[model samples]
Target: SQQGEEDPQALSIQEGENATMNCSYKTSINNLQWYRQNSGRGLVHLILIRSNEREKHSGRLRVTLDTSKKSSSLLITASRAADTASYFCATDAGAGNQFYFGTGTSLTVIP
Candidate 1:
């Protein structure tokens, strides 16, 4: 299957703290992308790391990929209340117009 699955379906952390989530997939992929959704807002892309990449970072977010294990991890450092949202991991199947996403991890950054 192309779908990725993330651990810790939910998490709650204090503002200024850090949160981490992991994702695992079953098929080969061209790239993996992370997205964040706040309440009813549309998802916003956080970062995309190609299959050839091992690690990538954007602002306070860091992502690591282990192709051998078909797994990836996302780390949010110094998270704020504004960071409260649902995070999802998506994989491009390398085929045209094909992508799959995980169920998502619900995060609440408490102030």
Candidate 2:
């Protein structure tokens, strides 16, 4: 297994519905972070759930971690056109605690 490998390489959802994506890793982590990146834009930090946390939420975003399974999921409530972007999971687990970014889930929220 990779350090961070996200599931559902692509997703399409209508506005107002929720979107969910999962990520799995192979190593223990200090924290796992989610990020959003608009096409041709820089990444925007979404949320960071620590190893001790089971879940965390921010605004319409919710994140859950299961260390035993080395997996995590991110859910965005009330999808919007503006939310169309690529979502990625990053873990602070590699050498020297560097971050490992996964292949993201590209989401298109149609209005």
**Model number with the top TM-score:** 1
Candidate 1 lDDT tens digits, 5-103:
988899999999999999999988899999999989999999999999999999999999999999999999999988999999999876638779998
Report how far residue 39 has shifted in candidate 1, in Å.
1.5
lDDT of 2 at 109: 98
- The TM-scores of all predictions, comma-separated, are 0.96, 0.95
Task: Give residue 96's lDDT in candidate 2 (0 to 100).
Answer: 37
* Whole-model Cα lDDT of every candidate shown, in order: 0.93, 0.94
lDDT digits (tens) for residues 1-111 of candidate 2: 455999999999999999999999998888899999999999999999999999999999999999999999999999889999999999986453478899999999999
* Error in Å for residue 3 of model 2: 2.9
In candidate 2, how many Å is residue 32 off?
0.1
